[model samples]
Target: MKYYNKLLLLACLSGALGACADDEIAAFKTDKPESIVEYEYLNAYDALKTYVDRTANPHFKLGTGVTESDFLSKGLVYSLVCANYDEVTAGNAMKYSSVVGNNGSMNFSTVRDLVKVAKGAGITIYGHTLCWHSQQNNKYLNGIIADKVVESEHPSEPTLDPSVISNGDFEDGTITGWGGWGNSSSRAISAAGQGHNGGHALKITNPTVGSDHYFVQTSYNVAFKSGETYQLSFYVKGASTGTGQVVAQDANYAGDPFLDKSANKDFAITTDWKLVEMKATVTADRTLILLNTGKYEGDLYIDDISLCHVNTGGGGGIVTNEYAVQSDFENGLDNWGGWGNSSTREVVDGGGYNGTKGFKVVNPTATNSWSAQVAYDFASELVAGETYYLKLKIKGSVAGNIGAGFQKKSDYSGRGDFPAMSVTTGWKEILTSVTVSGENADRFLFNVGAYAGTLWMDDIEIYREVKGNTIPLTPEEKADTLTYALENWIKGMMEATEGYVKVWDVVNEPMSDWPDPTQLKSDPNHTDTENFYWQDYLGKDYARVAIKLARKYGGDNQVLFINDYGLEGSGNAKCKGLINMIAYWESDGVTRIDGIGTQMHVTYSLDPVKQQANEAAVISMLELLAHTGKLIKISELDMGIADVSGTNIKTIAVTLEQHKMMAEYYKFIVKKYFEIIPAAQRYGITHWSPADSPDNQNSFWRKGEPIGLWNLDYNRKPAYAGFAEGLSGK
Candidate 1:
């Protein structure tokens, strides 16, 4: 993952230790032989903690992500943790799902236990997460909102009147299925509001006080199957403001409120009403779904509330009326996971065949496989054994293959790689006909993976044939519960500790791999059932919302940080990506991100040339983060000398020479942090592994390798001395 940050490189050349002239290097007193020997104090030993206390803010606690049992068991792990570090973070205990129980309940047993241990040692807990897309109870959070079934429902079986909402169009001259709520008043049937389908519509004359979102809605019972896919479609016109949002509440609306699957379609401004639709698989036998939107205290007319059972034809059949809005990219790339080693340009208008807006993707770097793509979640939308047509208007800088294939977000197997097509400079329709199957057909992927140039793509459409009007599919991420869930989780954590637990990794890994290291990760569509990619729901503004929530819940004095790995990677791609993200968040709106966490999960060898390169990257990465004017911290700092990077690791059986090399590398990085980053920007360092040997393989860094200042047996290694020297560069 090598990337060259031009601005960072320039800063390093002028200063950073690795690039300094011999005379400048000579100025570091600790590097002098006598000073090094003096700090050793004739072999007087100091814990890594002591060094941190002496040099970089003695009160500036060093932190690490640890397990609850390790500290609770009070094994060798606990002793080492207290001895070498002044702060602690639960690797998973403090996270969302781990602490959340049935419904949106809170269960902080592990966190409470860890907090006790930290309290005893005068250590504080660094809250791990309040917002994340993974490891969430997807079923619990997303499924909480169901169609609330009111008693006294007449027919128990499916009826010919397919309209889920009774009197949905208000053609009956009165509101029937419509449910007014929370200050919603002035409900009436408006003749002037005759819909695009030519009928009077239900109008909300006076909106709720804070109804900038979906407040008043239509709630009714639609008989649903436990495992069947369903969809909702309607025509909505914004109030006088020309904006509106359609929201769908869960069956348990009170328990999991504020979920809107059609958040994007909430605000399609036009006087003429347009059709909007969304797809979801029902989990419960029967439930109530609420359809509503918030307007600016004005009137909003609703018409043609209809629901249908969507048939996903993965078995290969004629298709029609697909989720066309998502394919069109008229608004922006929504629910589309964009990833690769290339730059994903903005969604530009006039780029598609229809001259509307289309997603512009470019291979900024001059390399093949400088790849990127936008993948859609077909989840239960595609039926088995159906012949489906995937079409997109595209003009490529180079001719290559683009597939509408099926693959998992993290481990895509490219099962749906269709026949390759060649397109010229002018926009052309690249169409593929594929018979759907139960193989790896989960997502509909549109890719430009290994192309060397730019690709302008838009107006994507999918269909085959339908005898009548095809049912439309627009994927909507009902985010009401998930968003509030994250907020509540953070609020709960803060309440538990009364804000004594001050710092946190508010957002993690908000950066992508190299080539376009300065951008968010675009590959690995996390739209799977197990993995809940937040970007899919919240988009790039995920960090901004997270930062704001932390500030609101944790109080004003909290130190919130954004953490990511590979920050010290070749060319500093990960680090650069984080800096760019922080900038985006701050400018996006009012946000409170305090520090930058460079999870220096690095690999290096005793090889001098390679080692030096690694050293330079570290300095430049730190310097670049410092340039952002935000607190710079080497969060989760660890280095593996293992063959994990194809270079054989110097495991426990390492020689004395190997030990010295390790010490030197540690010393170099710590000193560079202090030297390159100004005092104000220095957020201190956190050594990940206190002692090596518990279970390296499970750790993300070097699995099955030794990478700690203290040996597995708790004996201080040569690296300890090196760390001390670096921390206190006399």
Candidate 2:
């Protein structure tokens, strides 16, 4: 992290001309600085990219950036990449923040837009990473996992539509608040038989009056109001063959019958439970919804009584505008896996619509890939020839396309990816319409990801338009959310582009020097406000999950890897921690982790003992990784001079003697990589700063460090000779 400091942030906030100093500005002149030393071996061999793959035991790849605005604009940079590099990794677009927005909406336009360009040129795209702690959409995620209050359109003026009926099954006691008229003394709440849920049912024994078979209730008051519609549904049964007609009116004992007389439902009330329902409107103000059982009955039982307001309809008491919810995803995903494995989908907290617990699905980047989806049985609930509306709250690692539809369970017949929705960064309300033929409708499956990474879903509801209240889910529910997030995310990315992109840096920078446990470094640059640490919540096993996700998503052929920086430092915890991760991953039942990336951001001048110490430390680290039989890659190799102190420092030109020595270090590092690590275990090498000069004042590495193989004018530098020689094994 060059020129990265608190001062830089403060300067940007104060609207200063970047955090760089005036001297650095002067150092970066329009005119190219002439190199004092001329190299003899600069152009005698093939390009460094060709020479490395041509002579090595491994068919090594050369990767460079195509993220800079002028990557192909200067013509030289683009041609250099096209001619010399085997693969190009976008420095920023491949990162997470580039796609996810501030509101947690993922817009993969940045990624998709570039991938189109790269693919058109016949250049391959190396997925820089799948999961990492840096360059994350912290602004979106922090707010996503933050404490929130879900909004519900409940009646402000206290109303009663108990989510659950009041002792509907008579679990407590049947005659507690319930007393009937006309030979009601013989009736009582009985638990001698099985109840609806567990026990207790209202039993009406033998009755005397033939017409007064039974009458029920303490107060004939229906807990309802005017200007509202209510649906009364209940369960009833009889001992032997019994006959009865239950009436639900404005006090069936007397007063006006709110429901039509012809609509009165008749029942046999047999030995089995039967469901009967009546629909009516208050019209005017109301007091009670009375029920009278007419005719003969012996040993009758009633349980699970419910009186609730259904979705308000138009005039004429027609119950048309109602919806049967398919799933809320509140309780875990039980019968919700048909598209793929259930392990690929999970219910997580704090990601729901209206801030409730929801689910996270693997959403890949490609639109034509097998996506992460789950099933919800609504076959019995859906009405044929009726239009059903699906509503869900979703967020993703990147902006990807998605869809949903009602499908058959027996034959798995579904209009797959029919109802489309656009997934963004924030939890957004997406609506899709599915007209149900009401046949074999087994599940309402929503496909997530036609791009990259994981898609988070919450408050997944399929219901017709209705005004009501739903309970909200929140974060802090459990730790399963974080763990499952890693799982689904990896699978999503791998499944999306498994054909094109093969290699991925699974976990980036997972070691910290500041913390005691020395786990992952959280937001290394404290100045960047939108930084998220997966390790902070998931802890030590974060690496394990990353490897697992990569393996599961990318499959056996996927070149999965764990990458980190500062491996050359003397006994640095980052390097040791990386080695430890590899061991833990392999030993923890992991069979796939293809390689390890040592980001060699080395310096040209380490002053005597420190230089030797750096060399020994890197060689030891390489040897240790090689011993594991895992491939090793020099992920981001760059050499810098002109010390970058606490504040931004000027890039003063080093002596010609020092420049030659810098080139020598390049040769030495490459040579040591081949010599120490087994040829079969070599992945490849990469250069960070491809040009000798820095164009952006706020660039990632130290600006104007002359670290590239080519000079500002696109001429081969002395370092190219050293790199070429190292490749030739000279």
Query: Which candidate gets the maximum TM-score versus the true structure?
Result: 1
Evaluate all candidate structures by whole-model CA lDDT and list the values in order: 0.63, 0.61
Whole-structure CA lDDT of model 1: 0.63
TM-scores of the models, in the given order? 0.54, 0.48
Q: Write the per-residue lDDT of candidate 2 for residues 125-197, one digit (tens) a residue.
A: 7677777877887766565455334353433332223212334545434444455566543567676455554
Question: How accurate locally is residue 555 in candidate 1, as Cα lDDT from 0 to 100?
Answer: 81
Cα error, candidate 1, residue 705 (Å): 1.2
Candidate 1 worst ten-residue window by lDDT: 153-162
